[model samples]
Target: MSGRGARGDADESGATSGSLDTVLSFVTGEMAFDPGPYNDAYLDRRVTARIRRTEAETYREYRGLLEADEAEQTALLDALNINVTRFFRNPDVWTVLRDVLAELTANNRTVRCWSAPCADGREPYSLAMLARDDPAIDANRLDIVGTDIDGEALAAARRGEYETTRTTDIAEELAPLSDLDAHVDRDGDSFAVRRPVREMVEFRRHDLLREDPLGEFELVLCRNLLIYIDGDHTRDIFDGLAAAVVPDGYLTIGKSETLPREFRTSFDAVERGAHVYHHC
Candidate 1:
């Protein structure tokens, strides 16, 4: 519920969505967006213009188009989405994950992880590797589920096959930053997750803007995706995520974003520089 929806007087709401405005509107209403680079006018204009090329001329008209055509809507969503991801993209976060797993496994049951907005399929797969390679971590005991709103990304995630050469990039990932590094066998030709590693993850299309958590998790990663969503939606998402994690579970986000002050009380910072948090 970003500032996108109509206010009390303007809206009599149950639930409604599917327009460029719907996304833009939600973000603005829900979050205090960066007016300069990520402004309301900018978001509306960009979405409108992008859809217009396909004959969706106006914001309202685009809404009609989205509502009238499901496939078209999906395409529109794909078009608007920003999925800039890489294997083990954030060195710092990966560092925290490795340490946290080894430390927590010492006392926990099975470790459950949820990767939200798992775009194009790298993050979760990389995580699967972490569990499989770490001796202290019983890969069989780890279950990582990746969720994204886009069906395309979910499909890719399910396939679990990437060009072999892509793996090389991860081998030296964060090399200069050893304290921030997580061992990765960056060999792209061998990039495909082994069947066993793939078995550890479940990928699904979940609209974090809308859905509730299906089960509890020990660790949850909602990264770059939320920066696009407005505060209210982010808030709603975090609330749902919080409830979905065990009382002592961990909640992790991108190194760039931090939980709101209100939520800081709910999860404690487990690793300072790597930006990991655990339920208090």
Candidate 2:
């Protein structure tokens, strides 16, 4: 009777034999992005429903299911990451990046930029053009890193093969695609970034939440990512990012989101809808 009742309790709570252990692993383990504030019940719903596996399982038992098969890990991580990006996204923002990079490059000894959660190559690549067009900017001195939790996506960013479709926005900002210097390198269906700009960026699979994060930067572009995480997780990342920026450096977030109230003292709003942050 006692054994049956334990199972009954687990079943009623939608936590059968550790069924969602994999979910917890994703939040707290190697996949790296912080999980923030997941109350036990929220974990039960979000992870269980996210996996679409049987929900009547406990975290401990779910740990065993994960142990039984390690391959399930990637799919589970994929469920939580949100990848929504387009070339030269939000024209005004691109204009901001271009103008900002151009000015910073002119006077700064080194221009270090990070595109966190950069989906494929759009954001960093756009930064490349900002350098390419500005004669004062020496492409060699540029240090741009594109990091993401998704290995597959990071591979694509390194390859630099983007659909011709993403170029729709580029024509509006710079010269028509054909007139631009780099676009001239495309051979067929896909285009490769020319070497000078290509040399400036290096892509690596990085878990922003878990790994030893890089220390400092002139600008950090982490757009549309905070919306997926809870307030606690958001605050933790904001704290790390705040520390990562030079006292005079800048931080950027999604346009619709605001930094946690605690962060307001550390970061100053550079531009509002443009979603740019600066360490004042």
- Deviating ranges (above 4 Å) for candidate 1: 1-76, 164-190
lDDT string, candidate 1, 1-280, tens digits: 3544331212344234244445454334433233223334435555655665777544555556655776765564555566767667786688778877776677647888888879877888777777666676666667788998777778887876555344345345424333322333335344445676677788888877667886898888888866666566677878888898788788888877768888888788987766678887
Tell me the deviation in Å of residue 219 in model 1.
0.8
lDDT of 2 by residue, 37-118 (tens): 4334444555565445734245555455454555655555665554667666777776566656666677647878888889
Q: Residue 98's C-alpha lDDT in candidate 1?
A: 83
lDDT of 2: 0.65
lDDT of 2 at 229: 62
Residue-pair clash count for candidate 1: 22
RMSD in Å for all candidates: 8.3, 6.4
C-alpha lDDT of residue 123 in model 2: 80
